[model samples]
Target: MTVLVINSGSSSIKYQLVDPESGEAIAVGLVEQIGESTSRVKHTYDGEKHEYEQRLADHGEGLRFVLDLFDSVGPSLAEAGIVAVGHRVVQGGDNFNGPALITEDVRDLIEELAPLAPLHNPANLRGIDVARELLDVPHVVVFDTAFFQTLPEEAARYALNREVADRYGVRRYGAHGTSHQYVSHKASEWIGREDLKQIVLHLGNGASVSAVVNGEAVDTSMGLTPLEGLVMGTRTGDIDPAVIFHLSRVAGMSIDELDDLFNKKSGVKGLAGENDMRAVWDMADSGDENAREALDIYVHRLVKYIGSYAAVMGGLDVIAFTAGIGENDDRLRAEVLERLAPFGVKIDPEVNAVRGDNIRAITTADSSVTVLVIPTNEELAIARQTMDVVATLS
Candidate 1:
């Protein structure tokens, strides 16, 4: 049987149909620029890709276009034998620790938790409302935050007044949990050790680091929201909370202004006026002081996290680097490993230079801690969890 995984974003619908038994995607497609007059749908199946440009007024219309493409391009849904549908719900807000069947109550709960993930939950619900209308099947919500539910109280809780924090629902709810789960498990399998203490560095445009012990999340970098972790492409990470108050009182900046400033105008973008790491590196190579400083700060922040996480877990066994930057940038990997000499983490220069879609060990054989590059498969993780959740019902 095939499971359809739907990752509904604010303006896009990314989908894949996979056979849980085989773990291979039968079809993949994306409907982008929803609500725009000129939108596009790119569908791939049977080793051939087909693209269509049309007016997708909204997600519903875009979804309709997607369905039409599936019919036109072949591997029809009926032929695929889709049994259930899975949705990537970004923030479960401490309510759901795993995938849930999309009952009315689940839908309502997803809607209610919108405040926690203002930019994601609503859009996810929008897709849910549309997907339920379009496909009459058992729908499941695979939360991105669910895998991190294993985070201990000390790591999950904030150092704030318990009363106020609980009242406002504020704490460290790390993001990229789905990716962390996928790669950590993959790394464990690759290293032939299930209980190895691992650090997953998912360094994408929106970066996050997770401390996973024995395939369970113990700690993570992101907190309460996606904007709180390691310095991201745009969002400023690990800033003094009082900076907001200081700016408001002394600099006369409004809270909303501060929000936009930190979330959009900051990070590498704020420092070097470029959010892309490649561009930052380029500028640094060209002797741009601002860009050079930005790179230093970014690497320094990551170094501190690596050291602290090793201490938190008592010790480290492996370092699994995944996602865009971590998997591709050999220089950055070398730089970070160079700082971890005391941790006995040494990378083979030749091994570190390799890059591909498969799992790889970049560290030398004698290195005390294994260092690996594993590609993340979050959508497949969602699909597997969705299948597991549905199997329990049977």
Candidate 2:
């Protein structure tokens, strides 16, 4: 059976029809700039690409265009044998532990939890609502927070008043559960060991790190929201919680103002006015001192987490890099592993420089820790989990 993976963002939708058992995407498409004056649809299949432009007034219209393309192009949904839709829900919070078949009750619960993931859950539910109404397929809600359910309480809690935390549902509920889970397992398979301690650095426009033992998530970087992890392209990661007070008390910043500042204006963008790592590197190379400082700050946070998580997990066996920067950026990889040389971590410079879509090791055979570049496939992970959830239901 085929599974449809839908990752709907605030203004975009990414979808794929996949045969999870064989790990192949029978069809894939993206709807970007939704609700904009002019939106673009990029669809791919059978080694060919097609693009369309139209006014996608909302998620419903955007998804309709996607279905239209499938029908007009090749390998229609019926031919793909689509059985279930795997919707990527970002914040499952305290309620979910795995993929859930969508129901009226689940939909209401997701809407209720929107405040916990203000930027993600609403968009996620929007896609689910549309697909349910349009497609005659069972839907599975694959949560990004589901994998981190295995995180021990000590690792998942914040040092706040227990009563207030309980009342407000405040805690370290890590994001990027799908990508982290995908790469960690692939990392183990590459090393030919399932029980090795691993650290997965998912460095994209949004970044997070995960410390995994065997196949389970023991600890992760993101907490409560995606905004709490490492210094990302636009969000401040770990900061003094008291800073919010200072900004309000002294700077006269409101909660709304602070939210926009940290979530949209801070991080590398706040420092150097550039968030793309590639552009930031160029600026730094051109003697932009602020960009240089931003780079220092970004790597400092990553290196610190690597050591802390390694200590937490006793020792690190495989240090896997996934996502955009993690997979392709050779410079950042070298910078991070170089600092860990004292821990007997070694990278084959030649291997580290090579790039591809496949899993490969950058560390030498003699290195104490195996450093790998594992490409992350979140859609596939969601499809498998979605299939698993729907299978149980059937």
Candidate 3:
């Protein structure tokens, strides 16, 4: 069966068409700079890339452009056997633990939870509405928070007034559930032990750290929103909420202004003036002091999470790094491992040099915790879950 996964953001839409039987992406693409005059799309299929420029004022237009792309330059949906449309929903609240067949009630609930994921849920719902209108297919909403639903109440709850907390739905809702879920299974397979404890550090443009015990997510760093996790490409992770009020009252910034600032103007970009780690590394290599400090802060933040998660899980058996920075940047892997020395984590420098989908143990033989690099495939995880959900419904 084929499933088309749509991940819609404010100004962009990412899509993948996959065949679940072999777990291969038949096609993938993104529509960028929506609402801009020179909006563009880059779609790839059968090892060929097709690029086009057009004005896409909204998610509906963006998705239509995608379907038209496949119709013009690639295989038709019928030919691809696209049996289902799986959406990347950002928040499921406490109600959804798995992918749900999109329905009027589900859509209403997703709309109600929009405030929790202001940057994502609305856009996701827009794409959902467009896809449902444009295609005659079974639609499913695969939530990014669903995997962390397994987190125990002790880990998921916040220490606040019970009545207020319950009324406000105040709790940790971890992000990157698809990536964490995929890598945890891969880690279990790699070590040949399903009953092992693993720490998954999904480092990328957006990052999160998750603790998986015996194939289930126990705790994750991202809480309430993607902004509440490890330092990321742009978002300032784990800041005091008072900072928001202070910026609003003292700096005279609106909530929208503050939200846009922290979510888009901060993180490694605000710190080093560049979000790309490669550029940051290059500047640091040339003895740029600010770049050096930015790199240190980034790695330091990651190590603290690793240490904290280790404490949470009692001890770490395996540490697996995935996502963009984790799998491709050896410098990051090296720096993270070096800082985690106190935890008895050691990486074999030679073994860590390889990159991109090549899984290998980076840990020294005598290290107490095994360190590994695993590439993340979130769409495949979505496809698998979509299939599982469809099977149960069947």
lDDT of 1 at 145: 87
List the pairs of residues colliding in candidate 2. 173-224
Q: Number of clashing pairs, model 3?
A: 0
Best candidate per lDDT, number?
2
Per-model CA lDDT versus the true structure: 0.89, 0.92, 0.90
Give the range of the ten consecutive residues with the poorest summed lDDT in model 1. Answer: 62-71
Q: Model 2: how far is 8 from its true place, Å?
A: 0.9
Evaluate model 1: give its TM-score: 0.97
lDDT of 2 at 97: 88
lDDT of 1: 0.89
- Give the Cα error of residue 209 in candidate 3, in Å: 0.5
- Per-residue lDDT tens digits for candidate 1, residues 140-208, read 998878888889999999999999999988988888888998999998888788988999999988999
Best by TM-score: 2
Worst 10 residues of 3 by lDDT: 351-360
What are the RMSD figures for all models against the true structure? 1.3, 1.1, 1.5
Clashes of each: 1, 1, 0
Over the stretch 207-236, how does candidate 2's per-residue lDDT look in tens digits?
A: 999999999999999998898879999999
